[model samples]
Target: MTSEPAERAGVPRRSLLLGAAAGAGAVALGAGGAIAPPAQAAAPFVKGADISWMPQMEAKGYYWNNSSGVRQDLFTILKGYGITAVSLRTWVNPSSDPGNGHCSIEETAQMAQRAKNAGMQVLIGFHFGDTWNSVGVQNPPAAWAGMSYSQMLQAMYDYVYHSCNVIKYYGVTPAWVKIGNETNSGICKPTGSISKPAQMTGLLNAAYEMSKQVFPSTPVLVHLAQPQNLAGVQNFLDAYRSNGGKWDITGLSSYAQGGNVPTVLANMQTIQSGYGKPVMQVEYGGPVGKPTQVRDSLRAFVTGVRGFGGLGTFFWEPEGYPSFNGYNSSAWDESSRRPTAAMDGFLNV
Candidate 1:
C-alpha cells in the first residue's frame, strides 16, 4: 500500500502501491515484460472486492442501488455484479475514526458472517496493527510497541489464533487467510521489517502456524504490494523462503501501473513459477470516472492472470463512490449511487 495515512485509512487498509522503488538487495527484472500465459486453466476463479468499509459506510447512512435505481443491500448489489467473494481487513484495536478506524475483531467477524450469509467467500486480512500496515508503514500495535521480538511473536500468534476462533464462533469460515496486508516491508514494524529477514520470517511463521492450526484447510497468503516492482517482490520472497517462511498463496497488489498489464503479468508469472505458489491479485483499482477504461483493464488482467493460472483478483473498494474517504478509484457512480460499468471487468471471466 501507499504511505498516505488519510488515503490508506479511508480504504480500511493500505493505499494503492505507488512510486515505491525496489528494496536493497533486489534483483533486476528480466528484460521483456510480456510473457505467455501458463498452460493450466484456472477454474473457480475468485472475483471479489475488499468491502471492509461497508459497515462504516452503512453506519453513516450510505446505501447502494441497483441498475433500476432501487435501493438494495450492498452484498445483493455485489452478487448481481458477479462478485463471488469479499475481502475484509482487521486491526488490533482500531479507533472509532470514521474514515480510518473500526476494523476490530468483532466488526471483522460480523462482516465475515454477512459475506457468508450472502454466499460469498471471505478473505481475512490481518493488518497486525491498530490501524493499517502496508509497504510504506508496518507499525506494530501500540500494545506491542517496545516488546521483545519473542514477546511480539507470541502476541502475533495469540492475536491471529484468537481472531480466527472468534470468526469461527460467528459461523464464518474464511476461504483465505493473509498473514499481513501488503507486507512488502514485512509486518509489525521495526522488529518484522524485511531488512531483518530472520525476524520477519519468525513473525510470519507464528502467524502462519497459528492460522493453520485454526483453519487447517484454508490457504494462508503471504501478500506483497506492487507486483510491478519485480525486484522488490522477488527480494522479499527470496528472504522469506531462505528464512523458511511458509505460505500457500503469494498475494500481490497491481495498482497505478499505467495500464502495463504485460509487466504485471510477467511478474505474476515469475512469482508463480519461481516460488511454486499460487499467485493472486489481492488488490487493484482504477479511477472512478473512467469506468470503460477501468472495466477494460480489469477484464484484461483477470483474463491474463487466469490464462496463466493465477488466482482471481479483488478490486480494492469498488464501492467507494462519491469519493468516500477521499478515495477516487471506486466503481460506484457519484450521482446515480449505483455501480458503474467498471465492475463489468469481472463478468464473463
Candidate 2:
C-alpha cells in the first residue's frame, strides 16, 4: 500500500531510512555519539530499525535484554541508540502464523503507534498480497484470485488507498510507503507481472495514483531485490517507465554474499546514473559474527551509496531472532536481540 512525486519527473521522493548494519541481538554495534538521533528525528536520513517483527516476537514470549542483560522495552533501547525510524510490512490479508501478529493491517497500525510514541519516523511497507510478495512469487490476495487484469489494477488502487487511510487515521502518517515488496517480477504477478509490461504498469500506476489521492505528500517507492543484479534492476525499471509506470524513489535490496558489496554499490550508482532516480538501500545485511569486517563492509556500503547521492542504507532485519530467515549472518545476537559491532556503520554515519 503506498503515493507521490516530490521527485524530478517520475522518480519518487526518498528518505532512505534503512540501516545497513548486521542483525542485532546484544551488545550494540557501536559505542559512540556519532549515531545521534535521526537528524533531530526528522524525515530524511532517518536512522532506524525494521523491528516490525518485535510485536509478534513479543506475542511469542520472546523478549530482548539490554547490554546490562536486563530485559528492556525494545523501542526504548533503540531510541537510546539514536534509532529514529521504524519500518513495518502489512499484507492485504496476511496469514495468522503463530509468530506473526504484526503482518495484519490493524496490528501494523498498533506497531506504528508504538514507533511514533518512541519518536521514530514510520514507513509503511505494503507487500500488497496475502503474504510476502518478492522476486520469486508475486501472488495477489485471495480476494483478487479471479479478477481480470483490469480488475487487479483497481484492487491495487483500493488496497493502497485503504492502507494509507488506515495508517493516517491511526495518527501515524507513514513517511514512506512501498507500492509492492521486492517487485522485480512486477507486483501481483501473471497479469501484473513485469513479463506483462503494460499490464504491470497499469497495476503500479493505479496504486501510485490512488496513493497520491489519499496521502499526496508521502513518498512512494517500488522495491526490488538484489541491487547487485544490475540487469534485473535496469530491465524492470525500464519496463515500468516505458509502460507508463511512475515512482518516486528506487528502492533496492543488498546483502553480503560472496563479497558482493562493490557490485551492490556499483549497481546503486548504475541506477542513479541511468535512471536519474535517487537510490535507497532499503535492505542490507552482513555476517553476524565477523564484527570487524561486517562493520567495515557496512561502512563502505553506506559511504559508497553516499558518494552517488543515495538517500541512505537500511538493514533488513538486523535485530531479528533466528538470524533473519535462518541466515545467521543477517541477524544481530539473537539471544540479546540488540545491536552488534556491525551497527557501528550506521552509528558513526
Candidate 3:
C-alpha cells in the first residue's frame, strides 16, 4: 500500500496545519495540536494506526516538531493524539538495511516492545514472505518456494508458532493477528489461490491454529483489500469457508477518495448480518495535501464502523514524511516534518 501510492503519485512535501493553526476547515484539536479526548461512547473499538515505518523513520533521525514546538518521535506523537492501538507488519525473513529492514522479525518485535511500553495495544500482520505480499504478488518465502503444498502448510504452522512466541517474549501479546496480508488472490502462488480454496484452507488453518495455540485470546483476521468489491469479498469468503477456513474478524482496506464509503458501509452490514462476522477497515487514507478532506473522510469511516459493529480503523504508514522514500500515503506535513490533521482524525470526535 505504501509503495503503490508514492510511486504512482510522485507527491511533494505538503505544508502542515501551521503550528497550532489548523488547516483550513480542519478539525479543531487541543492546544499545541494535542489530541483532545475522544467521545468514548462513540468509539467502542480501538482507534489505531499502522505506523510500521516508526522504527525505520526514527532510525533515520526523522523527528516530528509537535505542535508545542517540542521534538518527538512519531510513536509518542501518535499516542499523544489518543491513539489506542498500533499494527505491526513482519516478514518471514529479515531484509537488510534501512530501506527494507524495518519489518523484519527482530525489528517488529523491538517496535512492538516500544508500542507496548507506550501502553498501546498491538496487532500483528504477517506478510508470510521476505517482502511485500499482495494480490498481484504472493511469492512463497525463498525457503518454502520449492516445497510441496503439504510441506508449505507445515512451514506456515511452524512459522506462526515461532513468530507468535517471539512476539510474546518481547512482552506484547497482539490483540489481533492477520494471518496473511491482503490475500485477495490468496498467498503462496498457485497453491494458496482462491481458485483453490482447499489450499487456502490448508494454509489459513495452519496459521490460525498455531496462532491460537500461542495466543488463545487474540482474534485472527482474514485481511482482504479492495473493500468496495463486495462480490470479490463474498466469493472469496464463501470459497474459504466452504474449504474450512475460519476467522473472527473481516479486515478490509479501502479509501473514500475512490468513492468507496457507501459500498464499504453496505458491505460491512452484509458481512455482519449474513456471515455473522465483525469487520475493521484496517487500512485507508488519501493524499496528504488535502488535510481537511482526508480527516473528514477518516472521521466518516470510523463513525460508520462504530455503527457497523467493526473493530477499528488504522491509517497506513503515517510516519513517512519528506518523500516517504516512495510511500505517498503519509499524513505528515512535508514542509514542517510533523503530522497533519489527517493524523489527528484518529482522535474520534
Candidate 4:
C-alpha cells in the first residue's frame, strides 16, 4: 500500500518547538555542532534495513532461499556491509494467500533470531492491523472489529504485551519497539486523529504504557514519517508531551524522494538536541524503481544521518521490489544470490 500524505498539510504554525515548552527557545547543538564524537558513535548509527515481506520475495519466483540459508544469509550480507540492525513488521493475522504470508509472528521471531545470530539489533514493527497498517490505514484486526473504542484500546495493549513477550522469551530482545508503524496520521484512523491532541495522546499513551509494561528497559520509539516537515514533527511531539506521553528516542521516517536529506538531517538534529534524546532514522529509502539512484541516495542519507547524531537507520526493504514479479530485488536475486547494489550501499556507508 502507498503511504499517506503528510498530516500537517496546509497547517501554518508560528513556532517549531521540539517538546512541550511553548515560545521560542535556543536550539541545542551537538558537540562541535555534530552529533556525538566519531568514537562515541553508537553502532555506526545503524546502517540498517527493513525486510518485512522478504519471505514472499522468494516465493514470487524471483530468488531461491539458498543464499542466506533461510534468510540469515541476507543478514550475513547485511552485517558484512556495516548494517547493525534489522526491522521486521508483524500483523495480527494476514490473509491465507501465499503471497501475503509475511505477517506471521512465528516467522517474525525466526527472522529476529537470525538477525540476532548475525549480530544485528532488531526493531519490531507492529502494524496493529491484519494487513498493511499505517497512519492513513489503522484498521484493527478482524477479531476486534466489533469491540468498542475502550475495548479496542485494551486489545491493543494485550497484543503488544503478548508480542513483545514472545520476542523477549525467544532471546531476540528488540532494541527498539515501535507501537504502530508511521503514526504521523495517527492509528485507528478517523477515531485516532492527532488533530484532537488529547485523543491522539490517549491512543499513543496506551501503546507507550503497554511497551513499558512489557519491556521496561527497552526504549519505545514514537515514529513519524517524513523528517523534512519540522512543523509536523514539532506539533506531534507537543501534543504527545502535552498529554503525558513519553518516548525514549525520537524517530523519523524519511524517503529520499520526499525531501532533501540535509534538511531532514538538520531537522533531526533540532529535535534530538531540543529533547536531549537520541534520534533514529527509523525508516528510509530511495525510489525503489531507480536502483542506481536508490543506492546513491541510501549511501548519502546514511552518511548524513550518522554525522547528525542519528542513533540508527533502517532501509525500507533491501530485498523486495514490485517489478520483479512483485518480488523485492533490493537484497537478493532470483537464485537467492547474495548482496545486490542496494545491500552493498548499507555496507559501504
TM-score for each predicted model, relative to the true structure: 0.87, 0.82, 0.84, 0.77
lDDT of 4 by residue, 1-349 (tens): 1101111222121111211121011112212333233443454467778876656655665552433455455555566677778898888877755545456665677678878887878888877677777645667678877776667666665566556666665677787887777777767655566766676665666666555555555677888776678887787787777776656677788876424666777888898887766788877765444556666667777777777777877887766655643644354543445445555556555
Q: Pick the winner on lDDT between candidates 1 and 4.
A: 1
TM-score-wise, the better of 1 and 2 is 1
The ten-residue window of minimal lDDT in model 3 covers: 11-20
RMSD to true structure for each model, in Å:
9.9, 11.1, 14.2, 10.4
Residue 202 lDDT in candidate 1: 83
Candidate 2 lDDT tens digits, 1-349: 2212111123222111111011120013112222222332243554656777777667667777665667788777676655677778888777667434237776787788888887788778888788767778898888897899867765665566556666666678777777888999887767787879998887776666655555655667889897778898889999998875667778887776436788778878888778755677777777787766777787787778777777777766666667334556544677666667777766666
Q: Is candidate 3 or candidate 4 better by lDDT?
A: 3
lDDT value for candidate 4? 0.65
In terms of TM-score, how similar is model 4 to the real structure?
A: 0.77
- lDDT of each model, Cα atoms only? 0.80, 0.69, 0.73, 0.65
TM-score of 2: 0.82
Clashing pairs in 1: none
Strongest candidate by lDDT:
1
Worst 10 residues of 4 by lDDT: 18-27
Residue pair clashes in candidate 4? 62-334, 63-334, 64-336, 68-73, 81-347, 318-331, 319-328, 320-328, 321-327, 321-328
Q: Candidate 3: where are CA atoms >4 Å away?
A: 1-43
Best by TM-score: 1
Total clashes in model 3, counting residue pairs 3 or more apart in sequence or in different chains = 0
